[model samples]
Structure formats: structure tokens, C-alpha cells
Target: MKILLVDDEESLLRTVQLGWPEPDDEIVTARSFEEAKRSLLPGRAGDFDCIILDLQLPDASGTTILSEVRKRTDTPVIMLSAWGDTQFRADTLMSGADDYIMKPVGIRELHARTLKAALLHRKRSSPKPSVIAIGNCEFHVQAQLLKGETHTTKLTGAEASLLEELALANGEPVLRTDLYLKVFQREAQFGDKSLETYVSRLRRLLNEHTEDGAAAIRTIRGVGYRLVA
Candidate 1:
């Protein structure tokens, strides 16, 4: 089974991976929002049997990303937060989080909850359609496909998620925080290079097919990026 772990602390991530005694499971770590989004995109929802989300992200707040995920996929998500108040718990659960875990939590409990949520989601969820059109390109949400007028290419799950967000923005520049949270599904934090790497790969895959297509993804100085119409 594949597990997506979203957190910013490198040590915690290392601890989770090394501490997990499960011999047959894969634990992938995402240090920020963008990284999570890549792992949790619609078509790739089944890529991870379970998701462990951190609540105190630098970019996103409340259950915005959680709501977004519910719209596209039914993958089980367990939200982890430092705040352990009853109010917070009520808010998150009502907002659609499958489960809420407090910080300084026991690894054993976390694992148990993750397993339970995964099982429940798999049994209860059904398939949903996911597709988007960006200018001349058509994006298949679940298939990670991008078809353009003259060329077509298969995108990685992360690439497809990022492209979908950009396409939905419709030529406007999207905030780095929003893109990171929306695509990676975590906060945009310092020293996280995943977003840049994905964008470069996206530009290469998406622009190489057409004349001057490289200009389509424009850098917005100190902001984020804007997709050309």
C-alpha cells in the first residue's frame, strides 16, 4: 500500500518512514502543499491508499484543500494538527476530514487510524469524472493525459495536477501558496523545491509540442505563475 505523508518537518518525516514497521507499505513524504497536491490528484487518488495531512501548513488553512479533494476523489485523509481542542475536532470532522489526530500523537494510533480510514474510503467511495480544458489542450484528470492541437503526452500525476490548476486559472497568475496547496495539497514553505521542479517538467512536457509554446507558462516576478491564453 502507498501512503502520502504531508508535513514540513524533515525529522518527523524521517521518523515516520523509519518507524513504520510495515514491511509491505510505501510511505511518500511531502514537505509542503504542492507536494501533497501532486500525490493526491484526482486520477492518482488511488495511488495512495491513505493520506496523513498536517493542519498547520504555511499556505492553506481550515479545510479548503480537504473540500477540494472531496470534490475529485474519495481517498481517505487523516488530518494532523497541533491544536487538540474539541472545537477544532468538531470543525474538521464536519468539514469532511475522515479523521483528526492531535500532535505528539502515538505512532501506533496514527497507523491504526490511517488503516481504518483507508479501508472505509475504499469501501464507500465511487468513481468520479475529472477533466479540464486549457486553451487548445484537453486534460484528463484521472488519466494524467494532456492532448494539444499538434501533440499529446502523458503527464505524471503531479504534473497533471499542477497543469489542471493552472488551466483552471484561465490566464491569470495563481498565488504560489494557492497553487502549492491546491496542487501539492500542503503549505508553501521555505526550502521546498518540489514546486519548481514540477513546473520545469510541466513546461518541458507541455510546451515542447507547439511553436513558441514555451511562452505559455510565464514567470510572474516575485509572485507565482500565469498561464498564457
Candidate 2:
């Protein structure tokens, strides 16, 4: 399982990374609200199985991050705080946090709670749609297929995920940074053109499968791309 740990304390981040019981589980750390926002970009939130957030941060409150997380994905969130105030705990829970753990929590207990919260979330969450209709063509999300009246094209996993994000937006612009992170599963470096290459390929497929102006991806200069259908 992939987990995101958001906290400003270098010591706590180091301790969690070093003492994490499941060696195979991947853990990503963010030191501030800005860093956490980048990691939790709109289309990228589903990449993590769970998020462990510090209730207090230097830049913003943990509940602020929790609100953003709830807007994107239903992934489990466990709030960690030094404060033991009942009202604080109740507020976090009311704001969609799946669990709350007081600071100075033992590694074993933290591990157990993390697993339990994630498991419960999975059982309660609904599955995403397997197929999406894009203008005159049909996209089989799981199969990575684009089907039209006379032809069908297969797409790479990255292409399919990129398309899925755009489709989910329902024609609204999707940020370039958000697309790059969601499709590539990492932060984009300067001058990365991989996303552009995928966009060009998808445009070609769309033109060939759909009517001339039925479906298209428009570039929002200096911003991102939007699907117009």
C-alpha cells in the first residue's frame, strides 16, 4: 500500500520512515501544506491508499488538507496531533478523517490503525466506472480501448489514465501539473515533454475514431488541456 505522511517535523518523518513495520509499503513525506498540496493534486489523490496528516502544520491546519483530500478521493485519512482536546478530535472526524491518533503514538499501533482504516475505506467505497463515452467513441477504461463505428485502438496505461482524468472533468480544464502527476505518478521536472507526446497521440486517435469536431482535446495555453466534445 502507498501512504502519504504530511508533517513538518523532520524527526517524526525520519522515525516513521525508519520504523515502518511493512517494509514493502511505500511512504511519501511532505513537510508543509504547499508540499502536501502538490502531492494531493486533483487527479493524483487516488494514487495513495491512505494519508497520515499532522493536525497542525507550519503553514495551515490539518483540517484544511483534509477538506482537499475529501474533495478528490475517499482514501482513508488518519489525523495525528499533539493536542488531545476532545473538540479538536471531534472536528477532524466531522471533517471526513477516518481515524485520529494522538502524537507520540507507538509504531505498532500506528501501523495497525493505518491498515484498519484503509481496509474499512476499501470495503465502503464504490468502484469507478469501467467504460466512458467520449463523443462518438467509447472508451473502455479498464481495457484501455477506444472503440468507434469502424475501428478500435488500444491505448497505453498512461494514455488511458490521462483520458480518464479528462473525461472525469467533463470538459473543464485539467491542470498540466495535475495531469503529469496523475499519469506519470511523479512530480514533473523542468522541460518534461512526455505529457505533450501523449496528448498528441490521443488527438490522433480521437480524430480518427470520432467525427471531425465531435471530440477534441484543446490546449489551454500556459494552463492545461480540456476535452471538448
Candidate 3:
């Protein structure tokens, strides 16, 4: 899994990077919101599965970034605060953060917390059933496929997941914040564009299977998206 570490403190960023998961796990460091923004562009951060963010920054508040992030992606945000106030924690949660941690936390504890948050978020987002129907189309979650009356087609992991989220919402608009959290596990960094790309791919594939074209998943514009029945 890929992780993005965002903080204004250079030493802290380096410390987290050095103590991060094994070599197989990729890590990216951003010292400011601008840097983080640049990193998550469309492709870079879109691929990341987790984000470790500091509440205070030299350029902008993490909450500011959180608001912006909620507009585009659903990747989990683990907020790190030096202040460590209970109100701050509550505020972070209210602002759409997945988890919050205080400074002076050990590497092992941070790792454990991050892992737990990711797992919980994934669990909460997962569809209850192995299969579900969306506008006359059946989706097999385990198989990652869409089945129609006369057609069956494979879907990419991301596409299947996006569809499943919409179908589970039962046509209600799933907020972009939730979508980013459920699908990407965290906010897309400055360079990550994979979210949009995957949506386009799913639209094309869904269009191929249904006469309604891509309208099954409607773009809510400035909000998020919805899967209509």
C-alpha cells in the first residue's frame, strides 16, 4: 500500500518515513499543502491508500486541506495534532477525518492505529451481501463482475467497488468525501488522478452493458456522485 505523509515539520516527516512499513510499502513526503496538492494531482496521490496529516502547517491548516480533499476523494485521513485537545479531535472527526493521533506517539502505535483505521474504514464501506443489483444489473462482489439479463462483463477492482458503493447507497447520493474514503481509503494527493480515470473507465464499461449509458452513475457536480436505479 502507498502512504502519504504531510506535515510542515521536516524532521517529523523524515522520522515517519524512516520508521514506515517495509520496502514493499511506498511512502511519499509533503512538507506543505502546496506540495501535497502537487503530489496528488491526478495520478500520483490517487494511487495512495493512506494519508498521515499534521493538523497545523506552515502554509495552510490541515482542516483546509481536509475540506478540499472531501471535495475530490474518499481516502482516509489520519490527523496528527500537536495540541492534542479533545475539541480538536471532535472537530477533526466532524470534518471527515478517519482517525486522529497526538504528537509523541510511538512508531509502533502509529502503525497499529493506522492499520486499524484502514481496516475499519474498509469494513464499514464494504457491501453487506456478496451480490447486489443496480438498475437491473447484478454485481457479484467477489467475482468483480456485472451481470445483465443477456450479458455478463468483468469489471476492474476499482470499477466494481465504485459500483458497489453506489448500489448499496440505493440511489442516494454518496458524498465525495465518503466515496474517496471508501474507494481510495484516503484523499488523493496532488499527483493522483486515478479516481477520475477509474470513474471514466467504469462509465464506459457500464454504458456498454446498459442502454441508459453512463447515466446510471450521475455526477452530482461539486458534491460527489450517485448511482441511480
What are the lDDT figures for the candidates, one per model?
0.75, 0.84, 0.76
Query: Per-residue CA lDDT of candidate 3, range 118-145, in tens?
Result: 6655655665788776656777878999
Model 2, span 19-57: residue lDDT tens: 999999999999999999888897899999899999889
In order of lDDT, best first, we have: 2, 3, 1
Model 3 TM-score relative to the real fold: 0.54
Error of 2 at 209 (Å): 56
Count residue pairs with overlapping backbones in model 1. Answer: 10
**Per-residue lDDT for 214 in model 1?**
61
The better-scoring model by lDDT among 1 and 3 is 3
* Each model's total of backbone clashes: 10, 0, 29
Residue 159 CA error for candidate 1 (Å)?
A: 46
Provide the TM-score for each candidate, comma-separated: 0.52, 0.54, 0.54
Error of 2 at 28 (Å): 0.2
